[model samples]
Target: MKVVRFICRILLGLVFIFSGFVKGIDPMGSAIKFGEYFSAFHLSFLGNFSLLFSVLLASAEFIIGIALLLGLRMKIASWAVFLFMSFFTLLTLILALTNPVSDCGCFGDAIKLTNWQTFLKNVILMVPVMVVFLERNKFSVRYKPLGEWVTLGILFTGILLVIRYCYFYLPIMDFLPYRTGTNIPKAMEIPEGAPQDEYKTILYYQKDGVTKEFTLENYPWQDSTWKWVDTKTVLIKKGYQPPIHDFRFTDQEGNDITDLVLYDTRYVFLLISPNVQKANTAGIMQAKSLADLCHGGNCAFYALTASPFSEIRNFTEKNNPGFPFYHADETTLQTMIRSNPGLMLIKDGTIIAKWSYREFPEVERLKNDILGYAVTYYREKRESLTKTILILTLLLTLAVIKILQLNFDRRD
Candidate 1:
């Protein structure tokens, strides 16, 4: 029983900790997910506070996991875990039944699960959390109460600093389809003979002043007296959707320039902002400066946005970005970059470099073969992320070892 309790705590604690950290690093993405939930539930009024809410939820999960893993204030931590899991379990159950939101985003973008799968995952996780809660008294602290408190305080401070840095700069890792090195044209392409959405058609007809629904197989379409009212097609089964579904660039005159831009062999700089009205002006200035930097070079510059023509025109007049303006879907722009005003460098339809407005590349940084440099920079970034993850895992492993050692020591 004691060994089982130990195993449960270790497993559940690791899951919560990892899940929390992933979502924590990309708070804006989580906030956007929150915004989606708000829209689904007709609670857009709370959208303004979404970031804070997301950060808080993620922090709580992380802190609770740390507390349990370290066996600090076990009674309180166990209770918190129980309550948290219970609330989420009920929420996922409701989500499974109603299907209001496509995903609950339990593991952020690190993993994807359907609503039913999320609910089942919650059900499975609940068993261990329940065990931890019931065996709370088994957890004992090796350090003094003050030691645990101090450690928690340090952890809290570190988390806040990391969150603040990521919020200002970009996330340390990019997990989206538009991440550096992704071939946009390739991601958007559907292969030959790919499965299409299977839908069943239903027709509504009014007969004797009564409207009745009929499937194609049993429809009374041959009868002249049956007047057609409406037709609907229901998706019986979903099909494969490309990662880049709605990516297109349109000129001011609504001419599609998607292929032209993607096929360009030279460097192409894309100034992307979902909504110009909300983007920070500081970033806009730097991006405009980049236009001048690329003018004499064989580079093509374009500002792709989802804002209306009126808004785009107004921004153009005010910013005077020395580049042409194009249009894309707002959601696609968001997925492309988290920053309100982000920059992407593309060549031959492949995204080579991406920068948040805060991290706009200076001319000095663009000093080499632009494509090769961007690829190198992306590789270095990945390596850095890998190192950070490794360091954290090592630290957590040490902590677990110490905690286990303390438990055995106490028994002796």
Candidate 2:
């Protein structure tokens, strides 16, 4: 019985550690996963709080894991672990039943488990946690001074804040759909008579005497010397607009204009945001600075929001931000960028660049993107053809070589 309890403790501790570490690496991903749950329930209004909740939940898991591993406060730690596992089991079961999300993201992108799989995994974990809960009174260990708990609490609080700040700026780690996403054109209607398939081709580039391939699945993170290009090859079915679309909104003054389409003569920076009151004030100010830079460069700029005209006007007036505030649908703006204050760059109806409010590049970086040659529209098609040809050629060559070798052996 004692041996069984020891094994259960170790198992529970390891499970918590693995789960917490995976989530810690990408708290933002966890936050987005939580947001998916909230959105499915039509509680998307809670999206703004997802990040905060993610940090707290992740910290709790890490702290509990440490306490469990150290065998400190067995009674409290066991109860906490059991409760946490119980809640997790309920959440996973609910998710599996409703299928609200495709992946539970229990381990973030580090481990992709389907809802049912996660449900089963959690159900199994419940056993150990339950054992610990039942036998906690019998468990004993050297007790640490009360000061240790206080110190740990303070340390965890600081860690949470730092993690939140990092995610708010440059995400320490990206583990979701948008991690190093391909830079594809946005806002174009699909032309008639396009292919229909989910086929993706990788572009192989030769650099520094080595060949490297970049595919939609393994992109952005490549060898330092290798460059990756994502050919946005999509088969357009009937009624399929191009994956990209310009954001059009009405300004506070009631003027109808498209934020990204203006200034076909130069780059246009469209800052997609919720109303100032709805967004973080600091984020708004940072976006305002970027808008000011665009204004100085004779580049067209607009701050798009979904708020009422009067509210936007009053907010702008009070803040004295020198950019035009435009109104768009709340849902549409959110889809364009997950961050509250996001920026998109468009030229000739093509999305040239995009940045979360936290990652808004300096003026010089924006200039570099504008000056670079925009990706050609036909590049995706060309790359797809090239990949198919290369693969077929390799197969044919191998077949011929094998046939020749067989004939020679027969003749001998």
For TM-score, the strongest prediction is 1
Residue ranges of candidate 1 with Cα displaced over 4 Å? 364-368, 372-412
Q: lDDT of each structure?
A: 0.83, 0.67
lDDT against true structure, model 1: 0.83
Best by lDDT: 1
Compose the digit string of candidate 2's lDDT tens values, residues 74-133: 888998998898888898888899988888877867788888999899888888888889
lDDT of 1 by residue, 75-128 (tens): 888999999999999999989999988878888877888899999999999999
User: Which runs in model 2 stand beyond 4 Å of their true positions?
Assistant: 1-11, 21-55, 99-105, 108-114, 134-140, 143-151, 167-170, 185-270, 281-289, 295-339, 342-412
Look at candidate 2 and tell me the lDDT of residue 207. Answer: 68
